[model samples]
Target: MKTKATLLAFLLAAPLWCIAASSYPEQVFQPEIVIYFGDKIGLTDEQREFIVSEVTTAKDSAREDKYRLNVEMAKLRRLLDKTITGEEEAEKQIKRLFEVENALKMANLKLLIRVKNQLSVEQRKQLRELMKDFNPKKIGPSEEVEKRLQAKIEKLKKGMREMVEIGVNPENISKVTAKFQPLINAAKYKEAEEVLDQAIKMLDDPF
Candidate 1:
């Protein structure tokens, strides 16, 4: 249960997937702000329940807004990819995309403000540490290792070229991208590629 809780803490800190693919370094959802504390931040059962209630309420409230915003990113991509669309329409979609993205962020911020006020000073510190640890690599690497890591990252970044060559979904490349981010930061290419291989298999499999 502790292990499960630990996993939830990390995954919940990550962006919530609703309908469309998010841009890289995806925006975190409102519910996840408090859910991040349910396991790793040492909350009492009562406190955890309260946080859960708050998140559930916020998620339900934001559902429609999130879904609408989710479609915009994909819409923008499709519009840009198609040559038939004029610059005027593309400009409008770009403007709407920014507005929708901001609205989604504001919705998250409103809930975060409420959650922030409820936390004690110690809990705030714990949240800070949690965030600090969430960053994959805080330590500096050797010069030689850094170069090799950069090369691997650049290669991984172009999944359209690399992933498709191996018969994986270029569209779902975000799955592999998300899976390897932490490993890439640690310069674990061998392990990272193993993860990539597993992701490729899953992506390639016909349902």
Candidate 2:
């Protein structure tokens, strides 16, 4: 009877322990990254081009304002850490920090608002579908699919680096989408799908 009770306890607890061990916080919020509208939408080729260009413009402008604010905040933090003996000086620094933080918050909000304005309802739904993470570990990456995905990822990284260096938005995300369309149409959709995933990840990268 004691042995039977022990076995029942082990059986009941094993699945619960497995689930607890695997559960983890998957969502992370990072403000500096540009989470693209394309990340959420199933864009028509034309829409992708227009949206990408619009977002790139908004983001570049936002980045300039954000950089200055960040510098000021860093200075304020340094001042706080120093040996400040006077209440007047401490109060001034605190005020400056709050002002800078508020400005940064507003700048980010404006950018998000602008991005939202550009997206249509259908596009928004598509974006949600695209942004979902595909866990290859659970889904099992086929060797052929993996190879194609890597190629697509490399291409996207190159394009992103070039955009940053040359200060040019890919005139249209449609161009990139069009470039992939043939491959997708040919039934090599895994590669194109994987490339689209890579593009979203690149846009999300903090740096």
Candidate 3:
């Protein structure tokens, strides 16, 4: 009886764990502009089709680069912790980490450039706006709404540089925790609305 109960509990928990792991925490490709353009801008079925495919390709490429770099950084951090002894080794680790970070930024920027080239000026604006909305890994509210947040992003870059001069990262867990929680809790919850424009294109299966 005890063994059977333990097995049943494991089976029940396994599905929940899988669901949690598989679900996108902040974003799934629920493109809002896709629906809007289909309905309001009257995108032909073909244009809709091409845009959906292009957008997915760009997003996936960006995500892959981000994940790959994060994994690399984690491995490097463990190696540094285990073996690095002096300031020189630490400096080398930091340099390699920064290079990897810059590469990832360049890759994402190139993908964004491709996205911009593929989209019309107006559509590109809408796409950015849509990305700001649906992209749940958001740093904070929209730049339009958060001048302080925007300024702080720049400030953080400057601060990071200064910290590097003094051999620090300036990444304070307590400070970061204090910075975002108020915004997170006070912000209104918005539901993800379907993108009809993408859906019309999705009739043919772009992903």
Candidate 4:
């Protein structure tokens, strides 16, 4: 997820409800400003530079956090594949994922507050006007994405167990998982699930 960039952009124009991006706990997209707020709000060069510096830092931090989470999750998946880990370990990693996600969300709020503090009243009002057109409902499930992934993980655990008992082919399962990975990255969990389901059904057919 482009946490810092998404949050910084949201902070510039979105209102309080839209303040933190449905928040980092969810990895869904939302309705954000089409125009650049710094330009529209007529920010001075100094203010713009400050915003850029802070945003770059936050973006870097968020990227690092995301990288770590992906690494840990991959480790946990490997452990599970080898039967070296159990549900408790997987659950711990999931909790850690949520923790990092929450921290990123807070970081965004902090930056948003800092940027707001630096803005003049006129600038704030200009931002408000730019934000008035934002439509939150039109956005898909870009928020609470981790929550969805957690739930999906549980289902996957059950599915794996069922497959093992049925002597399902590992290659077949891998094919389905690989096919859906990109969809998940695109934040299309529903479509990913559909892909998995169709693949499984076709592969499991006795005919």
Candidate 5:
């Protein structure tokens, strides 16, 4: 009974674990990556068509598997909710859920393998190089934000130096400017902008 309960708990938590795991993009070659860099990688028209067809088929299969998974999860919930559920029946449902999840993962793996096999050696090498520089966080705001933040910091630093040269207290400027890099690194643009504005205001009204 203890073992069955433990198994049940693990199975119940499995979906949440999968969801979290899926948040990170797989490092392996995927169809979307090929399509996105098709020109750069010199993908042939035939190769592009093949990849698109495979992706379409895989997406269809995944949709069906996801539907089946949701239905099985609902059934498991119903079984556990009953006042006199049998341990054996719950175990059976959990096993079915596990199988569906495994099938979904397998289908995705097959799709990725197919995509990888279709690419030429040189294209694959180029893709590998591209992937090396692929930081997911660099997807948005990009270099523009970094440039703007750097410019702001430089301006703040120059202002602080000038104020210090003139015998103004540097404590408040130091405290606020110290926060600029961290906020920028964390991509907290709004907070960083506010802090920048505050620094600018301080520099303007250093009294």
Candidate 6:
């Protein structure tokens, strides 16, 4: 009975584990982090321009890969739904899905690496110091803080909905909010606020 309970618990939590695993690794520096703290970090004009350019190019390039990934995922789901799938075909689809995901991951890593290379050691240190405040482990369970963050998230969601209603691309809004949800779920409220702020700014002035 205990073993069965453990197995059931694992099955129930599997999707959450997968989501946490697939999210941007905490150690990796997102371009939004640099952009948000640019003034405090004293980012040079050149550094800022390079980071933005690389991130923009990466997002554009990943669009096709993202589409392919979605299609592959759908194909795999359909295959799994069938009672007697061809093992070889199922394996091929899984491999293709992994390849697309890997390509997207590699492109993002390369972009971040280039951005990091552009920053001076002192600037990087400054960013690290600024980011310390958002570290989930360091934050206390303050009710006030939790309420504020939750309110901000709700407001942002409303704004995003409004944008979509006014013809803004829903996919663009979704891409930004995707990371935000996981952070919020993990009680990384400070980081979630930062992400939502940056997402709103990006959607408002996408150029």
Q: For candidate 3, lDDT tens digit of each residue in 1-207?
A: 444345335533442212321243222222333434333434455555555565567668767765765665565455545543465765676566556566655554553354345555665555445555453445334666466444544554555565568765444522442434332322311111112222223223323
By lDDT, the best candidate is: 5
* After superposition, candidate 4 runs with Cα above 4 Å error: 1-35, 82-85, 134-207
Question: Which portions of model 6 miss their true places by more than 4 Å?
Answer: 1-28, 135-207
Best candidate (score: TM-score)? 5
TM-score of each: 0.40, 0.40, 0.36, 0.45, 0.55, 0.54
Looking at model 1, how many pairs of residues clash? 0
lDDT of each: 0.56, 0.49, 0.45, 0.57, 0.74, 0.68
- Residue 179, candidate 5: how far off, in angstroms? 49
lDDT at position 181, candidate 6: 57
Per-residue error at 68 for model 5, in Å? Answer: 1.2
As for candidate 3, its clashing pairs are 34-197, 34-198, 35-195, 35-196, 35-197
lDDT of 3 at 73: 57
Steric collisions counted per model = 0, 6, 5, 8, 0, 0
lDDT assessment of candidate 4: 0.57
Q: Which regions of candidate 2 deviate over 4 angstroms?
A: 1-42, 125-207
Return whichever of 2 and 3 wins on lDDT. 2
Clashing pairs for model 6 are none
* Per-residue lDDT of model 5, residues 24-111, tens digit only: 4544576666666676888887787788778778879889988999899889878876767897998898789889998987787778
Which ten-residue region of model 6 has the weakest summed lDDT?
13-22
Better of 1 and 3 by TM-score: 1
Worst 10 residues of 1 by lDDT: 21-30
